[model samples]
Target: MAAAAATNVGNTWINIGIFAAFVAVTLIIVFSVSRQNKTAADFYAGGRNFTGAQNGTAIAGDYLSAASFLGIAGAIAVNGYDGFLYSIGFLVAWLVALLLVAELLRNTGKFTMADVLSFRLKQRPIRMAAALSTLAVVFFYLLAQMAGAGGLVALLLGITDKAGQGLVIAVVGGLMILYVLVGGMKGTTWVQIIKAALLILGAGVMTFWVLANFGFNLSAVMQEAVNMAGENGEAILEPGLQYGASAVSQLDFLSLALALVLGTAGLPHVLMRFYTVPSAKEARRSVVVAIWLIGIFYLFTLVLGYGAAALVGPETILAAPGGQNSAAPLLAFELGGEILLGIIAAVAFATILAVVAGLTITAATSFAHDIYASIIKKGQVAPDGEVRVARWTVVVIGIIAIIGGIFANGQNIAFLVALAFCVAAAANLPTIIYSLFWKRFNTSGALWSIYGGLISTIVLIIFSPVVSGKPADPVTGLSKSMVTDPSIDFHWFPLDNPGIVTIPLAFLLGIVGTFLSKERSHPEKYAEMEVRSLTGAGAEKAVAH
Candidate 1:
């Protein structure tokens, strides 16, 4: 079924052509920007030259992953209101980032989130913990993007076999490494800005076309979708088609909600973006701009999802090469045939490449700046050496992402990203909140919060239903868990996501560790951080240092 669906979606050569052109154009932009890479600042934070509007657009590009284009639309097409919940969770997350961390993080941190975290605390231990947590979050996120890339290109090119998809993922990983190694942050930022514009433009046109077909009536479009969904069409229109099955499922939804709402502020890649702008004011403005762009794109998803359901049907989407992840591309095929599918497929590929580049740079920057320079070399490493190490780290991280993506192919990209968010919120958010807000937050607290949350979240995920124990889909006879074997039933966690339990535990551990510690936080350092974060008085000097 998937092979047949793939063959009918688009001209394989056309899709490849569009993809090749996008890569060629973006590579030129990357090399053009590479001339700016003379210092660590340029490689890590784009030399702090981007305006708020530009950074905001780039933020939209980084934030809108394959999950936004492929996963949420598919979820909405198949599950109705419940699937739209992903959009709400993602958009609302920006509010948390804007209100809680954006300006302050920009003012306080020079390169990575660890710079802010270890400011008032004992530097070596705190930096180590923060770097570990950042790598974990980036690992999960890179896995999602790589998986999306593999499935997307495979569907468009009519590649049904695992080896073909694996090769595609490897190619994506190589491109991502090149972007980081040559273009660095400046190059990656330009790619993101370009990709974000194309994505929003593509989505906007599709939304308008879909609405025009239903006489510009949202109700008519939704009604037609329901009518065509067969007996369960009404279920799609209502809530609970996916997550309201039982008490456990309801709790799982809450976990997913908490993770999505809190995760953006803690995401290492997103938080690192705050430092790319010059001042707290620009950081704040960039958040505002990002919010509006992201909000608008999500609204377009609502229309596109229903349009796909009404026009293409859910069964066809499931039988496609990428399963739920193929809805947007399939809808493009349905609407504009070969040409539109080719265009949208290129946009989707751009989306994955841009995001993976951002994540890779963030992880590499954290390792070089925080762990290697601060902890290992004791700040004796020169800027050139640091950048060289970062470039090498990018290659290593890319290799890991390619392997992980191969194993993760064919899963719902949004669901996989939600797990990454769960890890971010659990491991990073508590420490960030405490370091910024609580004056008494010490090194012990930071270490406990980072390591405790990181370990517990990973452990619970290993034992969760997402990893194993879920029954096979009755219609498709495929296992729903990560482990596909029917006899793998080791899962002990009831919920699919561990956010509900792990988030609170992390916060509690921070507080408990603070009280139990003998080392008091440096009051003078906290005062400096407060003044700098609030007023940006020393932010520029800090960055220069």
Candidate 2:
């Protein structure tokens, strides 16, 4: 027992040491890049200097959140094959971004998603609508990242106190703000690149360890997972394990798949990364590279998930502080002991930091460039002034994230991330597609799509089982309601994800509003927009630092 106690003590120190080293390296990158962010262009778009590979790596880092790394593994550990569905959906979503949106966005957009929307539409109203949708997506995404950060820190660091959790949230919030304020887009990009490399390396190591333990035989690992699953062993390799086998469950799964597939094309942070590349061609190339890297990473999650179930056991994982979020770390511990666990934990922390920083920058850019500069200043704000407002907006957004993280503690990180994707798909994707494709799509249609998608997603999620209803405990079959102390469950929305309904509704509203409006159609401007979007004519040039 004494020997076990000593081992625990040593493990804790190793974890702390690795985490501290990661933090220190991230800060160094931030400070080193701080000097180059003198212009609004540099602060917002990395001066368009990054190679496709670099930007692709950063995109991977930004997209692969803590939920992807830890939460997905945990979900698989608990739910088996159903958890792998997320991986397929998420990877397929990049094809949408690649074929439909990537090049057009890079060619026409300046800094934020609003820039792309406002190119041919009435500038002020379109920017306002785009900004609203951008903020809506960013808000929910930020909440998920912040919440995941707090939960992971509390769990991995062995902090049991509420105050300790709050501190962790604040520290993470502060660092995210610092990354944006000091390093700007360039700094954030480099940080993401580094973090992505570390994350892939760590996950690769874990995957290898999992395979080695099963004699490098995939079938052996599967059999082990089956054995560990007991009576439900066969079900572990089937689809109905997580979402159930009902009509509603099928619809829910479809909705979730829709969100994961369409959402990536619309997310503000992910779209904003296209602006960092030099040309539409580079933007296209970046998505290809990102697809490869992200695809490989999700494949690793599959192995890690099954490995955790077979090796770490679900009871041990569920009993951990962060539940499913602890599955990967716990698996690391079992396979490679404390040092590997610590490395994986630190990489996960870095992943969260990079993602939140990207989100903050996108949100801040929307506020400063779209609302503040385009609307309030009527596009007359000096570049310096715009950049200054962006920095301040980062601080404000950071504070909100910290508070939201505190309240969002103990919520399912993966569920929150899915909600964010649902909103993005419903609100942003339709508008983006119509703007780039349909010549008759007017300001009214843009507004309708953005507002319709945003409002519907929020309302549906609020009434969904994920938010208001009590979910049945997997082991005990007991309902644990999150709504009220008296357990008032009012979840009329059968689907946890709103994308299946909301996405089509958003597209329909855009089309309806466009034809109904008496506003003059902008075929001439659309002609120009099409040329620029297709040929990269008059695209924003990279500013020299």
Candidate 3:
């Protein structure tokens, strides 16, 4: 597949410069945006001020990341029909967000999920639970991004030495923390806006070139994958034999697909991003933009997926610049050589930076807005102070995320992604949906939903086979600390993703708990939910442009 040894010096310098620019540009945006805030609304929600297009780009910035770029492509390289399943799951999950939660969320919550739940419930446990759940979701999502960014940045910079990647990620962690500190929501939104445009544009260019080379032929690539044996893994396109995965055995390809698609709407980090925008209508339009952008990006990914399998072979994924996750990055290099390769790497790193910033701020805001302002203060805090406290919380949360990434560096960390989706489904979505749509939903029901889902999902994953198998240790090459002698024979969980079990349990718990409680349906509240969510009643009249 290759004749020239890759010095990668050109790619490295270009990446460093781009990474530096993203940090500077992101901070400047955040700073300029931050200066506009006189109230907490401006700080946290941009004073309900984002335009439809700006919100749309922000949605793209929040949703896509290394997991989408690197993880999905690698899965395609390794797992056949099941790989495409992720795209279906991710794209469809947005429908659940768009059709069901969007307007209700806008109408019900002001700054946080707790705002919606507490709209009806007494405040004590509601704010605390919502904040905690949001934090947990943010922590895991942030860890995955930082871990990915540092790893890729190191490889792009030609510092593949283990210590080198760690240093690179630490720098990424610093940049993200500053992004939140200086820019707050305003700055973060702009960073997301620019990054989203670049990411989609870059992917579009690569896909165009690739398609031109292949006569726009999708079928040719799939056939090539079937025949090609990938790099280090010698991974053939055959379904049954991926690094010793079963004939989709206990874990059927269908369930794998289900976890990914169903998992999207449930992600707390993704959903919380909607709160930053002003209204339900804006949220709807934003989803349309995200779907359009994400859909196009994914279409391009299919090209990279097949291109890698066709040109590089699946085994070559292991040796590509960024490890197995390098499939997409390597595909860029394969298609356009060094200059295009540098641009792709920069865009890929921006994808990581922007996504993590969203995760960090979402977590910190939930903690401050929901937990501190709502629960602790009982709606009594000054808006300016609330914004200040949130800024500080961002610093604290950033430290926690950075620490987690360092501890977990050099590991596959792919499983962390699935775990995040599972948690989002279990903890955040159920409580959110019931509070908005179900009239019978009460405070007790909301609490139980959040906690019950959170506890069960986390407990299940810790003891699951991926963790239990004591799978390969990323650092020591020793067995995983969770278990010894990993095996498929004594499988505990039915499948890897807990969505099949946990998502349903989350819904059941919320509904059953609501029905059991005295139905405290405020007539006005129910009317309001219906108006805000289903129709555009109470909508602000648009100013003539």
Candidate 4:
């Protein structure tokens, strides 16, 4: 008992020290970048000058944070085949962006995603809706990050209670808001790059450890997982087990893979990163680099996940710092002892911080560039005023996210992140896709796509097993499960992803809305479209659109 207590105390100091270090580093970046904001463009879009490699690293840095490094590893640790499914999906979605959205989004829009779609329509309503949709995506995503961070801090620092969640989440929120409100994209990008490097290096080290200790044999790892789960019976992976052992397992594998692939294409935060680059060609190359980097990272994660299952045991993960999310740290500690474990914990924390930084920047930039300059300001805000509003909006949005994260502290980060993807795939993606490709897509259609998709996704989630039924249980102080039981429950949707369902609805709404609205078609618009798609011409014509 005394040894356990002493160990806990030591972990606590490490957590505190790591948290303090991240906070200090973020503040320095923010304060330093705060001084040089001479223009709104620079503040909101990183002056649109990031190199392909830098932006690519930043992209990987942004996309592969809490979800890729921790959530994926944790899911793999707990669920036999479900976690690896996430990795496959995540990588596939980049293709959608690369082949479809990348050039068009860059070729058409100057800054925000709304600029691309709303260029030919009324900018105000479009910008407002886009900002709201962006906010919704970022809000849930931010919660996931904070939740992960709080969980990491709690586990690594040995604060396992619910309040520990709140503490760490608040710390992350505070750190991220400082990055956006003070530094903008420039400061945020650097932090993301640093974190991405750390995450990749850490995963590489962990993979090496796994390989050296267990040889480079995949079959051995599988056998070990099956045996361990057999020891538990209630577990998913164990020795001698095969993939797709049951119907639920198959559904989980398919649903997770689909979410990873489609979710990446529709994610507003990721899309907005493309807008931060200067030209369409740059955007295209940026994704190529990201694909390579992200590919390597995900590959390493597979080893880490199987390693956790083979060596650490599933039950031990549940008893870890933050449920399944602690798989990476738990594995590190088991394999490399306290010092290596602490370093992994710190790298994970940095990953969370880096991701939150990008998210806050994306949402804040939309509010500044899309809503404020285009909607609220009616395109009248001066250059200086625009940057100022963006900086201010950063604080306001950050505060809201912080408060929300505080409320959602004790929950699962992966579940919340999945929820965010469902909404984005439903709401923003359909509208953006149609507006660019379909010429007949009118303003009314765009609005319906945004509004309909957003409403359906949220309502479904509120009724889903992850966060459904009652709003919140008072006596129990836990969210009432939408299903009678999360385990033996029934849901309208097959899996957590609302994309397959909601994406179709968004397209349907867009078609109906565009058909109903009798807006006069501009003949010159076709000529303009050809130019935008072909040669990236009509440069002078670019405005908020």
Q: Which candidate tops lDDT?
A: 1
Candidate 1: worst-modelled 10 consecutive residues by lDDT: 536-545
Candidate 4 positional error at 69, Å:
1.6
Instruction: Estimate, for each residue in 1-545, the C-alpha lDDT of model 2 and write its tens digit.
Output: 42233224226677778978988998897798778888888999989999999999999999998988897888888888999998899999999999999999999889988888888899999999889988988898889888887778766787768788889889888888888888999999988999999999999998998999989997788778888878868788888887787889889999999899999999999999999999998998899999999999999999999999899777777777777778898888888888898898888888888999999999999999999999999989899999999999999999999999998876666667888898889889999999999988999999998999999999988888777766666776545544533256788988878889999999999999999899998788899899999999999987865
How does candidate 1 score on lDDT? 0.89
For every candidate in turn, the CA RMSD to the true structure comes to 1.7, 2.4, 3.6, 4.3
Residue-level error in angstroms, candidate 2, position 505: 0.4
Q: The CA-based lDDT of model 3 is what?
A: 0.72
**Leading candidate by TM-score:** 1
Cα lDDT computed for each candidate against the true fold: 0.89, 0.87, 0.72, 0.74
User: Which has the higher TM-score value, candidate number 2 or candidate number 4?
Assistant: 2
What stretches of model 2 exceed 4 Å from their correct place?
1-10, 471-481, 484-486
TM-score of 1: 0.97
Ranking by lDDT: 1, 2, 4, 3
lDDT of 3 by residue, 1-545 (tens): 33123325246777667667766776766776677666666666766677767887888877878888877776676665456657777887888888887667765666676776776776778888888877777777788887787667655677767677777777777788887777777777888898888888887887777677778887767677777753433334444454336643445455455566666776766666666666777888888888888887777777777777777666666655566677777777788777777887887888887888888878878887887777789879988888888888888877877777777776556667777877778877888777776777887788778888888878777766656664665665665533444443344664555667777898888888777888566878767766765665664332221
